[model samples]
Target: MSTSYDCSQPEPRREGLAAASGAVRAGQLVVFPTDTVYGIGCDAFSSEAVRALLAAKGRGASMPASVLVGSWHTIDGLVSSVPQAARDLIEAFWPGGLSLVLPHAPSLSWELGDTRGTVMLRMPLHPVALELLREVGPMAQSSANRSGSPPATSMEQARTQLGEAVPVYLDGGPSGDPVPSTIVDLTAVEPRILREGAVTAAQITEALGHDVPVAG
Candidate 1:
């Protein structure tokens, strides 16, 4: 059984985070909290690790996990032709609950399912997650739940669902917001909201200084 680390306690949390980060570097799955919800993830560059993430989530090949990075430079490396509006949105809402789908860099060796030559990226607003990214580089992550099930908002819930598939769990208590991140697609001519969650269309529009489209 995996020992859950309570993030409220500094010493244990640090020790657990180090162990979790180690598991990630070893190509093992780790369940951790994000600003919006709990996520299960593995090294994005490890095809073996990512396949394990998919398997743990009981997800199909067509459904891909998003990549999380620690900084804008990492996003820049994975993305190309970043729209000006994208830059504006990144400045305003990144390091929080916003996800951007941009043109995938052709050089990335690992696959994220059938991405259709595109990738969704997020810079989460959590110290633990950011530290993990800094330690392990980008990670391939999905909500810590089996496909078609409700996403877990607490460490206990995530543990129930992911079980031994995730060897380490970082218990950051309950995520303050149960809502998922807002997904914005910049590959289109006009930036579009593929899925709306915590971030609203009005907020995105204001960030872009223009009206953005919403996919129906």
Candidate 2:
């Protein structure tokens, strides 16, 4: 059966992270709150745990999951390079609702499912997420919900949809906006907006102080 912990409540925050860390260490799936939305995560190094997470969400193994880190430094060697523009964007809007797809490092295992040699990466702006990432290290995560369904915005929704399949749901209250992150492929020549989400083209432009040509 799955466990729930209230991260907003001081007592449960510490215990929740400990439990979530234990779940990750045991190669079990965990549902946790991110800055953009709730995410289901597993130890990035464990293929078995990755498979379980995919099965829980009814997601195809072909779809690669994004890896969330405590900060850019934590994800440094995991990705090949962060484009200058992408670096500026991260400097401005990361730890918020932006996800960047950059070339993957050859040294890392491909279990995160980045068959295209790129990894979706983000540094969530939530204390719970930061603390959890710090404790458990980088985590392979995607929105916590059934594949093709609206992403869960609350721990209760994740619990109802995922049930006992997920090992733990770190309850940090309702996620804001109920929208996913803005995904951009920084590796592309013109940079492509893979998904129109919380961050808009105009907002990204504003953040960068220039009109970024976004591929369709």
Candidate 3:
């Protein structure tokens, strides 16, 4: 059976974090709140867990999930190198609504999908998510809804879509308007906006002190 927690209360928040952490470590899926929307997550380094997460969402390996970190420093270990523009962006919009896609360190033994030697990373600005991430290290996460469905903006919506597939649900209330994080691809010579959401292209250009192109 699956379990759900009302994270508004102190006791439940603590308990929920614990349960969510346990589930992730066990290679099980857990639903948690993020600044943009609810996300289904599991241990990032666990290939089995990653496969399960993709399967639960009815998604394929080609469209891989992104990894969520608890802090900015976590990026250093994940990627091969951090470009100056990436550092500027991380300083300007990290822990908020920006996702950076950079080349992963060749030494790391984890697989997210057909990432093509790259990984998308973000540090969400949510207490429950940050707390759980800090406890569980990095996690492979994606919007808490099946493929081609609307993203879940509340615990109920996530549960309704994911159902028993997710073992633990952390209820952090509604996510308000679903503005996803802006995605910046740092793999190329010049940074480009793969998808604009909560953060705008102008803002990213301002952050980098240059005009960054936005892909259609």
Highest lDDT scorer: 3
Order of candidates by TM-score, top first?
3, 1, 2
Name the regions of candidate 1 deviating beyond 4 angstroms: none
User: Which residue pairs collide in model 2, if any?
Assistant: none
Q: Which stretches of candidate 3 lie over 4 Å from their true place?
A: none
Full-model lDDT, candidate 2: 0.85
Q: How far is candidate 2 from the true structure (C-alpha RMSD, Å)?
A: 1.5
Q: What C-alpha lDDT values do all the predictions have?
A: 0.90, 0.85, 0.95
lDDT string, candidate 1, 34-107, tens digits: 99999999999888998999999998769988999999878878976788878898899989899999988888
Q: For model 3, how does the per-residue alpha-carbon lDDT over 144-200 read when each residue is reduced to its tens digit?
A: 999999999999999999899999999999999999999999998999999999999
